[model samples]
Target chain A: MKKQQSRPNILVVNDDGITAPGIKNLIEVVQEIGNVVVVAPDGPQSGMGHAITIGKPLRFDRVDLYPGVEMYKCSGTPVDCVKLAVNKIFKGKKPDLCVSGVNHGLNNSINVIYSGTMSAAVEGAIEGIPSIGFSLDDFSQEADFGHCKKFIKAISLQVLEHGLPPATLLNVNFPKGDNLKGIKICRQANAKWAEEFDERKDPYERPYYWLTGVFQNNDKGEDTDVWALENDFVSVVPVQFDLTAHHAIPVLNTWTFDV
Target chain B: MKKQQSRPNILVVNDDGITAPGIKNLIEVVQEIGNVVVVAPDGPQSGMGHAITIGKPLRFDRVDLYPGVEMYKCSGTPVDCVKLAVNKIFKGKKPDLCVSGVNHGLNNSINVIYSGTMSAAVEGAIEGIPSIGFSLDDFSQEADFGHCKKFIKAISLQVLEHGLPPATLLNVNFPKGDNLKGIKICRQANAKWAEEFDERKDPYERPYYWLTGVFQNNDKGEDTDVWALENDFVSVVPVQFDLTAHHAIPVLNTWTFDV
Candidate 1:
């Protein structure tokens, strides 16, 4: 008989609140591999980025969600969920793997910076845990995650086996549905949301704005995450938390800082 | 007579709310260089990061905070303030330069990811504007910003003269006090907050948590932001919006994708 293997402890989280179907699918997939514990936002926190609630305290409580799968909901951003999980529940013993999302929207290219899903994963990486954030190109409550599960399981297992580079985490995004073209390791595309704020006056005659935008892809490279998703392929981009543009340092150094 | 160049249009913003002393100091510095338009949050959004307000409407209104400065206050995060400034105030005519903060606390090293000030600068860079986020090592309401003004004016002029590299912004932090040892070009230090949730109870006995932490600096490199601040030098790190760990892409591509 092979030596008895130990099950890894997996911490699951998402930005789309604790009850969202995307996270439910992720929970089911990871439960098959390890002992799962989920600490997610109590309400939708889409586009929260790396925000942490500073001026206010968080409301965290236990919830009876899926049977045999322990879960808790925190009234905070996705990053706060991970921090609470790591500090309160795990008690400094970090989970073997921290997986965020299977989000109901795309978080490729420049969207990563404004994505609560990826931010949760980035926080995990900062906390020294091997982490992956998964998202689908679709942004609907009923968006089916059927096709993405097997691939997520495979990729997560690989990460669990061969740990990621230090200070790095995986941002894995899937296209809509089962017409698979396999996985392609990619870089974040040079694209951004060309935002347009819809201005409307309230009943009291005060001006208010609603944020809306169009996804603009200017980078025509085939090796970008945007390209992979557009071509019906799974894109795995390795994201780093160190925002320092190291190459630009020498160029900036040349500038005289005299007043 | 010298060539009469049109005055640069400068957009000023901060996460420390519209009336903060830090932002007032920043506004004073930029008004000396260009035509200033201020759009900042109505309340302190210190750790809001790259978050954008999606689930709610924003209240954007003009305020007479300072005479001769066109200032507006938004009921949103710092990133939202930039978007509103671009969409409504600037009306697609992007500003010559965007300056965020003279933040009450330092946003060096790992704090960059969790900083609204830096995120605003990052947002400006994404919008093809030369941006800079300034911070001080002090965290007091009445922190002395007198010594920081001359240096800020000089740096802003230099950036206006020589535009930064594409997709890049500056994360500039000053040491507290009058004895600044000039500027130092640096990289973000490898440091992080060793966070511990301060648990407490409300009136009904339900537990709540207050996020608090001590910064832990593991990187000993002299060319880092932490080092520059420690040496009483103003640190300027060229920051990028591209979150891709491009170096790790090839290594990930080598992994087989078959389940």
Candidate 2:
């Protein structure tokens, strides 16, 4: 038998399937720090949101995608893949950490909700694991990942050294290819896409609509992730899954409802 | 002409179908409040999360389900329904208020992430409209909705009169049956479902698994939605869409990282 691999078990996952160059680069970086096990979708699941497949059966198959990384392509959402990785694939062996993405586009601000990449990281955090979701502002197949390796390694090492709080994960976004810059920890910018549906004609000459939009950032706060990324820095925001708006509860209680 | 049906423009939606008894009851109650416009899923989309279809073409058809309620079943997520309703159906005129679900079960605690019912309401809030997502703790088709009518009316009217703050909506979860003691404006409980998959054999002896889980509450605070619902009180949590952990930013900024 071959020598058993020994190192910290790092579960690697992404939304852009097992074949994306972004994930390939991510796996290569993760391999330096630990034994990487990739469990990703078989195809692109961009803008899938925090969806989980419940109506259908999920399947996982081992695939030889990354050269030395042990990888599996699963027929499920990003959240489902994390579940399968933790529950079935690594049943008895708990992973030291789970890292998702290095996604093609940004998951800053409200895009985090619609991001399958962040969902995987959030799922890992929910399972009480230290997790991080990384994204580049560039949305291209050939987007440069050279600048991200150092930062990724640094953050991963930090996460390993200092454990994350429960039910929380890091949402890390990098500026597209340019001269090197530093890193900044910031809050998720309060922003959204002002959607404008493009109405087009189909082959049958019927009107069809495509969901498209332009990102609009109304928040001008200097401490926001959007601002930080714009200022030539990698923005890291500690995202939590528990969306409790704790401050609003007291205000709501004062509302009179005498019925 | 049937007097042109001067009705009060109410938007009705749910995680369940347009034909579900929950929405039907909700529509009936709202019909007393406004002219109802029903836009919901074609089938049950429970635990669908906040998924919106970006890669597929959406199809919608008009159907006559509830008398005097103009209904349309859309092949899109709950958030998509709200979008389509705002863009296509009510292109020019805004509805009085968007109400989503007298849903089959509770969307308390961390269940809000996987809640399609709340997604619809969130979509409305994003569009600068007042919205509410109401759910009963009972997950049965025969769950009694008689007790919900009065409370629903009161809350909806209050929202109509005193408009909801921008980017915020109410997440109201009622206790099962008619013995609701009162209403409580509470925060979301620190709770999550511990997932357990049951592996079994299919007809051809093929292995398959079903997702199952138990709700685990780590918090016992009386000021929580879970606690209020458990004690026969309706829980109303004012929900906001901004996912930024603003408080953690300063703390994260203190961490040392190189360029």
Candidate 3:
């Protein structure tokens, strides 16, 4: 309820590392509307999903990334960055709004499950903060994020002004073109990646594998995030962390799962 | 539809390394009912969530840990193990059932979101397979699993016989005790980890942090997984990967998201 702070404290995070252009553009946009603090991965953590560092301790350090913008980098996954920001940096005095990514690639549909960028935002939502994750469809190092800045600002302002529903976060994805149609409130498209691993031999002739996949969108629904992006519109999906399929509980009760 | 094969082809995976006692116990129980193929992490990948390795290629090799059990160990996450099992090992033919874990610890409530064990089951569900993840509410290396086998078999048989609801997986958690009550169908409890970082200075005087937390469950709903676990009953929560907050969509549509 108190996410609508005047000169809101915005925690900025991403999966594409601290140095990526995506975070820079996002920081610039968020700074216009709030006091920004950036805590991102020290390296590209794409496809890191909702992973956290448990097997090893983390190295967190403050860095002078952008002039006048307080920033830090962590040697862990994107979700780790959010935890560090909340536990260590912010120290439980949570930011008013938590925004993750203007990621180098799309985090639409099923990609949200495997996106480090989105995972950071999910962690923020779990911390009872109004959170949003932004992503641009382009994946190159020099991917143009110019078209996304205005929309990002608008969405962040709206979220700060009107706090999000409890346990929910916004998943926003923008298409590649400059002449965008508009914004669409959409559901996550029923989609997945068809994986193909390229098997190769190492120097000693031991076999190794490279993970690759083709984006597959079989959902023909017009109200899906994937559909909105294809039509040049920015897509926004309200996502929740409760994984329970509430609908299935009644049917499962009919089963005899015994002692 | 064919998860009820006469001799089910079960794809087994875990976040714990291939040699972990948890998976070994799981494999022993599953062998009586189906042909099992296990693809698990080469090392401990706890808290890895749904991460897939994209930054580097993976090292996958066959291991002879169990006699006549088709087992492979991968230098990747639990999610990656499911992917490799489907694409590389099974060549997309698909397994009859995909079961992940018998994790060394609990993956109930909000822990499901950060659990590598549950993430593997989620991956399997995404691949349109009938999947389930099992966890015992004990974090000890020598945790007793003898009481869990019969219940595990009963649930697996039910799932194979009846099949899970589409795009859903079962997150089954057992309360650690030989005098277990029984199984109860439940929903994910609204909960989170109140994280605290144990900051320490290294030998070189550089600061580091060990991520720690206390599980906080304020949800008083008697129909939640937490309640089921706490009351000495096995918790069987039907989980889904669709992060879309369908209920929030109608309200978000009322927002003025402009061009």
On lDDT, the candidate that comes out on top is 1
lDDT of each: 0.94, 0.84, 0.94
Q: Which order, best to worst by TM-score?
A: 1, 3, 2
Candidate with more favorable, higher TM-score: 1 or 2: 1
Cα RMSD over interface residues, candidate 1 = 0.9
Cα misplacement distance, residue A118 of candidate 3 (Å)? 0.3
Model 2: docking quality category: medium
Q: Model 3 interface RMSD, in angstroms?
A: 1.0
Clashing pairs in 1: none
| Residue-wise C-alpha lDDT for candidate 1, range A1-259, written one tens digit per residue | 9998899999999999999999999999999999999999999999999999989999999999899999999999999999999999999999999999989999999999999999999999999999999999888998999999999999999999889988899999999979988999999999988899888999999888999999999999999999999898999999999999998998898898765
lDDT of 2 by residue, B1-259 (tens): 5566455578999988777889988888888878789999988877777777788777777899766669998887898888888878888477879999999989998888878898888878777778899998888898899899899988887787677766788999988778889889888888877776678777898666567778999998998899999899999998887776666666666666644
What are the per-residue Cα lDDT tens digits for candidate 2 across A1-259? Answer: 9977557789999988878888998998989989889999999887767778777776677899657778888887888888888888788467988999989999998888889999889888877888999999888898999999999999998888777766678999999866647888888788877665677778998666677778989999998889989898888999887676677666666677757
Model 2 regions lying over 4 Å from their true place: A1-6, A201-207, B1-8, B202-206
Off by over 4 Å in 3: A1-5, B1-5
Q: Please write out the lDDT profile of model 3 over residues A177-229, one tens digit for every residue.
A: 79898889999999999999998999999899999999999999999999999
The true-versus-predicted C-alpha distance at residue A259 of model 2, in Å, is: 2.8
Clashes of 3: 0
